[model samples]
Target: MEQASRTVRGQGMSSIKEVVSSWSDVARLLRGGDSGALVPVVIPRDNRGLRWTTLVWFGLWALISGFMLLRGAWGPIAMVVAILSFILAALWWWRSSIVEIEEGTVGVLTKFGAISGPGLAPGRHYLWHPWARVAYVVDVTTEIPYAAPVLSSPTHENVPLKSIEFFLRFRIVDAIRFVQTIGAGNFDLVLSNSVQDAIRQRSRQVRTERAYDLRGSDVKDMQELLNRQLTRYGVQIMGCNIPDVQLPDQYREHLATRERVAKELVAYEKEWELTRKRRIDTLLMEIERSKKIRDAKIVEVKASLNKARKDVAQMLEERETEAQAIRYEIETQARTNLVAAQGEAKAQEQLATAYRDNRAVLGYELARRRLDVGANLAENAPRPVIVHTDAGSADNSALSTLLMAQLLPQIQAGAASRSRPALRQQPQPTGDEVAQAAGSAAQRAVQAVRGRQK
Candidate 1:
């Protein structure tokens, strides 16, 4: 409030000091400057026409009192009157002439009881003490808290509501109108009345059971309404709301009962949905199990069918092998019989041919038979001991003759023994006779063979 403010050329005046600084401003302010720099409210206690008169009177009064005190007045009443006049002039100078406004507070100035041009900014200012004065000081910056708790308001159905507590915060927007139109002392009544009226209108819009909707709901409409109604009075509603509401006891109990029923209905719906899902799942599982059983049975049947086919094929193969073996055995037996019969026929033909040729070869056959008999007879006779020697060795020949001589006796003994066997066989032939008989027989066989050759 003590800061010096800038004064520009065309911006006009911002302080009371500038308003009364010049002769023209002082003249205009004396003519009831109700059009500028102060609240528009009129006081009508002081007059603008007596602007010079009041100033001259104020100056004269102070001078006279000072002169009287300096001259040392003798009368007691005169001294007291002069002292009071000075005191009055001082009080007028301090309270009316000087305007000292604090920060956040707007100052309203009255020029001879008429509001000046506009609200005064925060700062100290000097004005015509006897004519202009600061009327009201208002804090325009801070918000004011207010509440209106209504009792027994009716709803749209005319259902009686218990209570509705309304809360808000407000601040001043127009300092001049706020202080002049509605002072701070009576503002609370106006605000409370407006709040009650708004609450009633809101309650009438909702049903009794839904009155709780008023609480904890965005109340922009209500707040806007209050702002419109109270705007002229310079009050700006910042935030307004219904913080609490109450219903009748019986209505509260009924709402609780309805809530419980609704909750039970929701629970039953969920349970039914779960049971249906479970039933579907169980049916699907049964179908799957049946499908698996059918597949297993089919596999078993196919396996058995394959086994039967394999067994049949094996039996057929065994029968075929046995048939082949029997055919082979039969063929082998027939071939053996055929071979044996053919051999016997060939042998008989050869034997008959040999008999037919036997008479033609009779002599040769007889000689061969005689030679064979003689060879057998010689082989059966006792062997003589003969000496072997080289032809050129006479001594060896002599020794051999001697050995022969010695062996002649033993040989004669062997011949005697042989003759005894011959005597027993009815006469043993002499050697020369045996030789002559064999020769005669050979000569006859030769003649017979030569005749046949011719």
Candidate 2:
């Protein structure tokens, strides 16, 4: 019996050695020829123990199987129960390694105690449970808002300003950094604090009225400032908004009162301007009327002056005509007088010249005048007849008278010749005249006789 047992043990040992050699060859084949060859590589697993509950259940199953074997009841079934208990323990440990990352979210991984290569993307992912953990499962797509408290104004140093409500929208950009610094569970609280800090700092630079008016720009500035702070924690700020603002009641009432007073002052100024314009208009109208009156007076004076000048001109013309007529009359009278005086002087000269040239004619004219006077005396004298024949008788007056008559003519001729110095001197007649006178008497008697006889 001992030899038979030894032979069987030798055969079992040889079979066990053959299985070990085959396993070594399979390990060498998996290792490949070189380090750079394309071959499946196994990562080193973390050292982790099974869960206490699994171990306890496995121990309980082993104990049960051992007790069953000691009692010699269904030995193969007890072994199968023990093997199933080990499998149940393995599956229970593997449950933690099975990770399901939801859509739009990523799972950050950590091996042992340090961060691993990259984050796990959405879908089913396996990890070494209890050693490699899903550090953080962050939603990189969804935005989360952080609200801040009311802030004060910088303009009014002591005055409390409006209550400003603001919100910051953010999303996780780096899941690894987010897990390392601000974990997903604490992101809201940390972002809220950062937003409050940004609001407090930015509010100090803006006035209350300006903050209310430019709320959009103010919120945008807060978002940018908050992002600078959150970037360290792997968070990004997407947007910001200031929804409501509330001011103090007292300040609003003060502004309203000031506006009302300004409106009243403007109305008063406008009324004063209107009154001044009316006064200026009245003065302008009076000035225009005075100018018109002055122009009319000037025109009237000019007309009067022109009429006076015309009258003076006419009077001067009439005076000149009368003066010319008087001058002409005086000149005509002077010329006529001159002509009459010249004619009279010329006639006297002619008469004096004729008398000087004919002195005998002048004597003849004087003699003729004396003869005419003697003849007239004789004609008027009375005739007396007386006879005296005695020669020496004193009564011979008749003969003497005849002789005187004959000599009278000769005496007048001699007197006329002596009176004119231009006439020739002549002697008086004596005996011849007496004899001529006696002959002439005798002849007269004979003729008287002859006439009687006849």
* Clashes per candidate, residues 3 or more apart or on different chains: 9, 0
Question: What lDDT score belongs to each candidate, Candidate 1 first?
Answer: 0.66, 0.59
Give me the runs in candidate 2 sitting further than 4 Å from their true place: 1-49, 52-73, 94-96, 156-158, 184-190, 208-211, 256-454
The lDDT of model 2 is: 0.59
Worst 10 residues of 1 by lDDT: 9-18
lDDT, candidate 2, 69-160, per-residue tens: 86576666666677777777667677746766666666667777788877888788776556676555555676644455454433335456
Candidate 1 structure lDDT: 0.66
For 273-358, candidate 1 gives per-residue lDDT tens digits of 89998999999999999999999999999999999999999999999999999999998777666654555454444444443444
Candidate 1 matches the true fold with a TM-score of 0.41
